[model samples]
Target: MAAFEGAANPSEAIESGYYVHAPGKLLVDNISNRIALRPSSSHLLLGGIGSGKTTQLLVACQQINEIEDIHAIYVDVSRYTDISKITTGVLTAITGLELAKLIKDSQDKNVIESIKLIRNLAHGYTTEYDPYDDFYDDGGQYIAVKGIIPKKTEGYGISLQLVETVSKLAKATFENYGNLVLLFDGLDRLDDAKAFMQVVYSDAKSISSSGIGVVLIGSLTAIYGDYHDTVDKSLDYLCYQPFFDVENDPEAYNFFEEIIQTRSSEDFIEEAAIKALIRFSGGVLRDFITLTQASIEETYLSGEDKVQEQQVLKAVDSIGRNQLLGISDNELKIIKQILKTRIFIPRTDEDLRLLVRRVILEYRYPKLRYAVHPAIKPLIQQILD
Candidate 1:
């Protein structure tokens, strides 16, 4: 039950006793502390997919909101707009919408007008105008003046307008709430590193310049690929949330076990089954939950009351097979090389793709290491043999 629930909401996860502190660096505390010390500073939080970046960002937002004279806003970009088509204007518009909610009752007419403009832009409303008179032509025939043309705003013009609007919102938030810090989640879900960089390059500085603190969730490619230096220099701070080193560190292993024990009782799931789930999860929180949930289903379908090691393995294999689907032959070759050597040098776009897909899991503590996801390891080994 509890184990099957996703920790998408940080508050619920904490209150329900399902939240476990990540070992080593505390990402949530680190980001919140920086914002608390300097409310206008910008931070970039980068991690692999399924690395709990969203949960961490939400938690940081909550902590920052508790600080005196500072208001933290958590914006899930994916929920507000299509991540595949995300742009600077869309991001600024979404920020305006969220900030507008905070100051909806404000008497400032300028802020109110800006909020309306932002809502129109976010909702795809366009202004139409007639270029010619609609009077009758020769022979008293009614003229329709072709069609009503929607006024087009140039890309640069739109960018400048959005920047001005966001600046106004930032100032209004400061005047009313003391300081505004925005935690933007789901930008990391962008299709590629180039797209992510474009979003950040276009507006991160402009927003931060308005004395608004920003925390953006970014993908692994943003930190590991060619844009790494540019991204690093653009942000005031960078926090990389790596997968837990459960296999090599006893403390991390115990932390994950605590995560499971808090969610489910041993009477329903055996200790060995929990260990197998953690081991195959490769220390990724999402996979850990997925494997546990799948294992529970496996047990239930078998008419069993408790989940055993056998059921957990079956679940792992099922998930691994699903993961292997659509993987190209060339990609399989690359994976095989990494699996054999336990060394991954991300030299090309393919390597970055592997990293993003979690086909190759990167562990930071106890020295950086890369390996195939544990659930897929046995299958890879079989192929090697």
Candidate 2:
């Protein structure tokens, strides 16, 4: 469906709307094949925020649906923390109705059939099938998105709910094609990443139980932290795998470098710039792209249109101030305060420990509590003075 993000500046973006999918070879090869969805919980697409998990999932979904005899669906599960909104988005995904089309159908289909496909596909909150339908059997009633009462699927039944919903949609999607695949997008931005993963794993478990097929996209590093105790206790048998494993390859800078060069709307960015980007970002893919994007925007401001190394440095300084300094204002303040006391926290954790050892050796010397980064030390000292 064409997105409703409104008319784009097509003239300027002949190349602007491009996006680069990163961590190239690994994702291009392993991501889609890692899981056996048949007789298994629907596969989870695991990565961190800005890890390009969504892009990978979408591509995978598109690839799967292209296969003969397979059906595919992509649901946006990130927004379904509520009853009404959940009902609307879920309904739309199931029926393939663009929000605009669903609303426009309000007058033509009366409301029910226009939304019947939507309501029928969602978990009716209380095992109740079509609460609105109680009023009329074939009344053709569609719920407005404005006042949706959200019903989140819980661990015990959430798996059943999403899988059942997808299975029904699959039947219709592949009536002619023979297989069904559903893709849920934009998960990391959801309010509770932990809850979403629980829902996904739970749904996957249920699907595995019933032997249905679905694809879940979400973050990996954050997942273990979310339900560690439960994973050890209840869900270990499900056996999930993350998309990227940095531990196996200590020399993973190449992976970071590859992500930096992923395509945007069109033009292939210079390979050298991509390498420069990976280094500039400390090997974080998302950070690398964000820095490049910001720098590219600045280049436009500087009366040029190409991203440059100097502009990138400017982007880093801004990002460092916003992310590092803004988040650690109190810590920075304390660091500055310690400087006034001739105390410094080591730039590295080890250095801080060594300084503490010195305090121990010379009891008369003031005990040190923290250390400031040498790069910022001068400014901090001046601030305190």
Stretches of candidate 2 above 4 Å error? Answer: 1-28, 34-41, 78-174, 191-194, 206-211, 220-222, 229-276, 303-307, 325-385
Q: lDDT scores for all predictions? A: 0.79, 0.42
Q: What's the CA RMSD for each of the models?
A: 4.3, 11.6
Candidate 1: worst-modelled 10 consecutive residues by lDDT: 146-155
Model 1 lDDT per residue over 23-53, tens place: 7668998988888889999889989988888
Query: Model 2 over residues 295-379: C-alpha lDDT tens digits?
Result: 6666668886565666666665676554434324555554555656856433543332333222101111122123332223344
Q: Highest TM-score among the candidates is held by which one? A: 1
lDDT of 2: 0.42
TM-score of each: 0.90, 0.54
